[model samples]
Target: MRGPRTQTERDDTTVEIVYAAVTGVLLAGAAFALVMSPVLFLGDVPITTLANLWRAAKITAVVVFAARICWTLRRFGRR
Candidate 1:
């Protein structure tokens, strides 16, 4: 068996995990959109009140998450 990981190794692993997670999320979202686009239009689902609210919430979450990630990257780059 090998010894425990060093600080640098742990940091690298953490960075890799975060990058993979973000990439996976983006790719999954894209794939989902591509696959669901046709089905969404096929249905006559009206853009009613609750539907708009849910969509707004989803958009807000995505925007906030993106902003936070960008801010963190900028902060790190300044160091």
Candidate 2:
């Protein structure tokens, strides 16, 4: 039989794997958004809102990355 793993050890392993994956996904997504968001969201907005939407998308991307990191940490302990 396989040896037992305490919860913390399992959690650590899961976190290490998932965090790496999430980090990659977030990075790729952010790169795509940085290129496409300004065109999609602000392409036709007035002068002021154009810049605003671009900035907002960027800020949101940062928040998304942060949230994913936290989620990876949080999901570690789950069965």
lDDT of 2: 0.69
Q: Residue-wise lDDT of candidate 1 within 1-79, one digit each (tens)?
A: 9899899978966785586558545754665465446546667645674466456556655665565566655655565
The TM-score obtained by model 2 is 0.50
Worst 10 residues of 2 by lDDT: 35-44
Off by over 4 Å in 1: 39-79
All predictions: root-mean-square deviation over Cα?
Answer: 10.0, 6.0
The collision pairs in model 1 are none
Candidate 2, superposed: residue stretches over 4 Å from native: 1-45, 77-79
* Candidate 2, 1-79: lDDT as tens digits: 8799899888778767777567957774776477556577545668667667667766776667666666766676474
Model 1 residue 36 CA deviation (Å) reads: 1.4
lDDT at 4 for candidate 2?
A: 98
